[model samples]
Target: MKISAAGPDVDMIRVDAERLHNMVSGHAFYSELPKDVRGKIGKRKAPHYLRSQEERNVASSINHDYYNSATMFLSQYVHTLPFALSQLSLTHAGDSGALQLVSMPLQYSMPFMAKAIAGIETLWPDMRLEMPEDVRNLADTWDLLAEQGVKGVGT
Candidate 1:
């Protein structure tokens, strides 16, 4: 998200948004702003990536649904401390045990990795990048297993 936000896109670096970034990234100065202006800004989601062509194209691609759903799901486990703590109860420590704790985040991160690769391929088509066979095999295995009502963990 930060990568796309910090990209060379003009709209991504809008004056108002840069001002907001400057305000937050420096001293805690939000209170210095007028109450009405602060309220309006606080009520909205900032740095809206949908305004960017790259993000819009990726959002409209084959990975659209999974991208949004997984991002929302994973973002909770990531950014919100209380929600992440609450989800610890859902962690199944099987034979792999505590390693599941580490692996689970990496598993959820796969979609982001895929999105990055897709972006690279889109931006540099001459590079003719290809998904590694093992990655493709795992995706196929996941789809096949999902059809059988299996989550494909440890499979």
Candidate 2:
């Protein structure tokens, strides 16, 4: 729980676990609850527009704090103009940097998978015991994948 930044910035502040815990404890605001009880902020009404400032701020804050914030209805990149212009994602050939219809050699997917495994292990210790046999087997395959040095797969 360390924050290190370089700048002459006067407003720069650092937060540790305890500080954050205090900030968001039982004292924190609840959207459903009245603003007075919830630290006296906004009005007690839903936004007229889906992309309103309040909506955007809440969406961004949730995405920042939570690890798995993906939802079917929401796009985190909706506010970014260039991202929409790029049409989600663009895959280019490695050699000539040519735009390829084929998405080849999914690079570093294994690292992300490993991180997902670690996240699950941390969040739910009994997950392996409760998991289905086939799912467990699939998870076990990661060890073999690591041994083979499949891109970004490592112990």
Candidate 3:
């Protein structure tokens, strides 16, 4: 699938969100801390530490905020692939050329296709997207692509 930033013409870029997550999460600075220390420093689910009133002003001074930010940023980037593909499909009106948009969903993957469409709308202001009437069941779509020798995102 073609994707572009800041332009109407779609472009191909090798963006493996999993690899990006691995790179970020596997960093010694982020990963070497003891689990308890990590837990104490950052919320396990929320991606950021809770700052008390006294800490709020100084908290913003920390340089590692982006590290904390990456937790959710990378999570969303990794998890949003299928939804992105679906939205891209809609944007192209299910043009077969967009079929290359592929994603391997994680265990928590649910129907975020609508969020993806909204993201596309926000990202591409003038573009219009619509889901195709002939959209196949998820399994069938994968099977059909597999039969045609199309390697999926993970391969």
**Number of the top-ranking candidate, with lDDT as the measure:** 1
Task: Output the better candidate (1/2) by TM-score.
Answer: 1
Model number with the top TM-score: 1
The C-alpha stretches of model 2 lying farther than 4 A from their native spots are 1-108, 126-129, 151-155
Task: For model 3, name the residue pairs that clash.
Answer: none
2 versus 3: better TM-score goes to: 2
Tens-digit lDDT string for candidate 3 (29-48) = 87676576556445423235
Q: Estimate each model's TM-score.
A: 0.40, 0.25, 0.19
Residue-wise C-alpha lDDT for candidate 2, range 76-96, written one tens digit per residue = 344556743364456444634
What is each predicted model's overall lDDT from 0 to 1? 0.57, 0.42, 0.43
Model 3, residue 64: what's the lDDT?
36
Query: Cα deviation in Å at residue 43, candidate 2?
Result: 46
The predictions' CA RMSDs to the true structure, in order, are: 12.1, 17.6, 20.4
User: Candidate order by TM-score, highest to lowest?
Assistant: 1, 2, 3
**Local error of candidate 2 at residue 19 (angstroms):** 16
